[model samples]
Target: MHTVVIGGGVVGLSCALALAERGGDVTVCEAGTLGGGSTGRAAGGIRAQFSTPVNVDLSLASVPVWESFEERFGVDVDYRKNGYLFLAREEETAAAFEANVEMQTARGVDSRTLSPAEAREHCPQLRAEAFVAATYCPDDGVADPHSAVQGYSRAVEERGVDVRTRTPVTGLSPPESADGPWRVETPGETLSADYVVNAAGAWARRVGRLAGVELPIAPRRRQATVVEPETAMAESVPLTVDLDRGVYFRPEREGTALVGGHFADADPDVDPDDFSESPDLAWTAEAVERAADAAAYFGPETRVRNGWAGLYAVTPDHHAVVDEARPGFVVAAGFSGHGFQHAPATGECVAELCLDGAASHVDVSALSLERFESDEPGTVEQNVA
Candidate 1:
């Protein structure tokens, strides 16, 4: 069977790769260069920590792929298993932390609860006054997002999957007859496919409109900053998150740290290509000032080296929208901010939909579109910002 996967971000490339591996002639269509979306702008935090079994499982499944990509695809995505620190401020908030740890531990996530003192022991510079407890995961880490996506795209391309860049799908047409599959349009062209995967990332909702499906995925803006910190770089601090504040930091190129993660009240839905490469001074200032005051390791001595702003295909509940939205149409976008981290598992699941009509390893019904009919809670919250 021939499949046409739209969007060329990490999730799209992943689905294309998975379909090609399943012996389907796959064609990937991207409006711009591959990995040009949030995949390139993400902080690249990869971890097995989660508050849900499925999310933890997905992360656990993906970390190995990130770790072994060099061997499997002959590329290193700068996979660094530095570990993670989830910090909380008060005892009241520690309940969620405790629950998350239990779930993570149950799924073999190597999560362990830490006292305030224990948290300081791992990062001597951490301000113990800032938090009450933390859940540390040694197996969690960060990777080079762009490198990771490029590696996957190349590996799948070599496997006979057609990856076409600068090719945008303008519309989608389901077969007039129930037995037929799908038809899609690009720039001055149209094509047929047995399967159509809407891996369009932040633009997933727009894609759904083309096919007469309602995808609630919205493009929300997220910003990150690169700071040249004067403090000594920690080679092994997975990705540290100030849970109470929703801010995170990790080592970047050079003796610097990449920091950001406060949702703005003015979060806008924007075109994936409509991004600012230069750091936003206002946003950077806000993040740095708050971070410096919160952690002893942070200070005004740091310079804003650069910043990146990307779109998050946010859902009402923040979990990914992954399911067969309709017959012959699969949705695998709206990963919120965990797209790069969970691409492998999601990709394989997408293929399972094309092959067996359902995944044997994971029950992804929780991520289906119908869940939004009642606008109830999501399946997972451990990974959402």
Candidate 2:
């Protein structure tokens, strides 16, 4: 089967690679350079600590792929399994963490709840008195987002899949009949494919409109800042999150760390084409302050090195819309902020839907666009970062 994938982010590249591996003729068209979208700007976090079973299953399926990425793709993605620590400061949030741990543990994730003292033991930088409880998963970690994107791009090209950068898909024509192929239009030429996968990150809703389908994906701006702390941070320190404050920090290069979080009532619905790419000074100051409360090493003396803003294709439920939205068209977008970590499994599922008419690896039927048409849309995923 001939398949055309829209968007050139990590998810789109992975889908193309998986399709090529399945012996399907594939072509990937990106409007800009590879990984130029939200994928390149991602924080590179990979974790299985989730409140929902479907998300946990998706992460579980993707973790092994990330672990063996360098060996399989011949590119070192810098996969670091240091871990992810989530701190809860209030009783209600602490109870939620307990429930999340129970849900994650049932899904075979080795996540355990810890006391404030125990959490501080994992990272001496953490302020022990700031939180009531925490959750830690030793296997959850981070990787190089750029390396992963380039790795998958090369792998797909090696498999004879045509990857066209700077080739923007202007329009899409769904099949005229049951047996007709979908017509994909570009500025230079027109192409036909048996199937089309819409993996357009922040522009997924627009891409869906081209096919006469309406998707709930909206672009929300998120920013991250790098701080050079006055004190050095231990390399073993995991990515720590203050769930109550909506702030997080993780060790970056030596003596530096990356910190970011959303402020209460600060979430902005941004135009994917026209939003600030640079971080705001006020938001950066707030994020750094929150990070300092979570980790003592991120003191007030910490200097901001740099920062950038990226868009997250947020859905109403804050989960991914990963299903066949239209006949001959498959969607794997609107992951809120979890797209990078879950791209591997989502790609496999998209390929499975295109080739086998069903997804066996990870069942994503719950993420269908049809769910929104009902009175109850879908479950809101609580572990978004």
Candidate 3:
């Protein structure tokens, strides 16, 4: 069957690859260059320490691909298994952390709750006195987002998928009947597809509307900065998160760390086409200050090297909407910030949805858009940084 996948980011390319591998004709339509959107700006964090089982399952299914990316895709994504440490300052938050650890562990994740002192073992500079509890998973780490994108792009091309860069889908028309074809219009040409996958990250809502579906996906601006700390951070240092303050810092190099978070009380949505790509100077300064508060690595002498801003296609509950919105139309967007890491698993699930009419690999039923319309939604993932 002919499938036109929208958004040529990592997730889009992945879905195309999976579909192509399953003996389907696939074409990828990207508004910009591959990975130039949120994928290129992502921090490349891959972790299984999630608060929900579905998110954890997604991570588990995707991490193995990342772990063996070089062997499978013939590209070195610089996957580092340094680890991820989450810190909770408030007692209530600490209790939540402990509960998350239990859930994660029950789901086969090698995660465990840690005392403040025990957590300090992973990052010696951590202010143990400030945090009441922590969680760590040695298997969680970071990778190169661009490299993964390149790998997926190359793999999809090898599978005979048409990848069109700088080609935006101008319009979309659903199939007239159950057996009809969907029309996908681009600036260059109009393509016919038996199925259409909406993997358009920040602009998913716009794409959904073209098919007469109202997707409640909002684009929220998130920024990150790399700083040369006063004291050199250990290369083995885990990606530490000050959960209460929404600050997260992971070692970038021997003496440098990448710091980022949402510190503002109000997170207003931004236009994906017009937002600034560079990080704000004031926000960078505040990120460093917050990082210092979490740990002593960032001192007064810490210098901001560089940073960039990206958009997170956020949903109301911070979980991705991976479901078939209608027959022959699949929506796999609103990853909030986990798109890069979860791309592999989501791709497989999308392929299943298109080919088998359901996802057999993972239970993504709770990720459907209709859940938001009901009174009860899925569990909210609280580990978002």
CA RMSD, predictions in order: 1.7, 1.1, 0.9
Candidate topping TM-score: 3
lDDT of 1 by residue, 94-200 (tens): 89889888877877778899987888776777887778888898888888888888798888889899888999999898988977869889986898988899999
Supply the TM-score for candidate 3: 0.99
Summarize candidate 2's per-residue lDDT along 104-155 as a digit string, tens digits. Answer: 9988999999998999888898888989999999999999999999899889
Please list the residue runs of candidate 1 whose C-alpha ends up more than 4 Å from where it truly belongs after superposition.
273-277, 379-385
Question: Model 3, range 188-235, lDDT digits (tens) per residue?
Answer: 899999999999999999999988889999999999999999999988
TM-score each candidate.
Answer: 0.96, 0.98, 0.99
TM-score of candidate 2 against the unseen true structure: 0.98
- Candidate 2 vs candidate 3, TM-score winner: 3
Q: Give me the runs in candidate 3 sitting further than 4 Å from their true place.
A: none
Q: Which ten residues in a row have the lowest lDDT in candidate 2?
A: 376-385
> Which ranking of candidates, highest lDDT first?
3, 2, 1
